[model samples]
Target: MQREGRRDSWEEEIKENSSAVERVLKLVEEDAVVLFSKSGCCISVAAKALLSTLGAHPTVHQLDKEKEGEEMEGALLTMLAAPPAVPAVFIGGKLVGGMEQLMSCHITGSLLPLLKEAGALWF
Candidate 1:
């Protein structure tokens, strides 16, 4: 009975987490700007800071090194085929490389225009 209870609890936890992940994925897929980032990475931090500075509240998907299994890695690889790296930015479902590219866009004042083009900005 105790074993069955534990299994039920674990199943519930899994279901809850799966639902959360699905929700996040749905938001990412639908959003104009989404970032797949690792928390402690410098580039990730920089990318987030830039977005914040621009007043762009991008949807961030935090990838856990330990929790993201082979399937997650494969999906990321498939999604971002070239110059594979963390802090991958997606604009309108298109992969936009890493922090450096983001910074370049910001510096060139193209970021806002791109966001506007994607119909992502309210201001």
Candidate 2:
């Protein structure tokens, strides 16, 4: 049986994670394209480069540099149901998945339309 104190602590953790999720949601909404990333993460670097190359100006949050970065990253993974990874991309407030998914979209020729629809691209 779990002690009352233990249960309370668990609940607190959930609340904290939820709050982080909320912050991420707000940040994602602030731009047409947002990338939740870690500054030193190679995958994140690749993701940013890919978006830039495609002429999409993505607003990137280097979670590792934020106050609750690790927590926010964990919350994003949970909220988006994405793999545990940095460089989670959102297009017009919609989860666009990570690098692999983004590359797939680009290869399939669907990324440009999404960028344009999100107003990240004009032409």
lDDT of each: 0.67, 0.84
The CA lDDT at 56 in model 2 is 93
Q: Give candidate 1 misplaced runs (Cα > 4 Å).
A: 1-27, 65-70, 78-84
- TM-score between model 1 and native: 0.64
Worst 10 residues of 2 by lDDT: 76-85
Cα distance off (Å), candidate 2, residue 7: 22
TM-score of each: 0.64, 0.83
Best by lDDT: 2
Off by over 4 Å in 2: 1-16
Put down candidate 1 lDDT per residue, 23-70, tens digits, no spaces. 445656788888877668778877878876777777776777435533
lDDT computed for candidate 2: 0.84
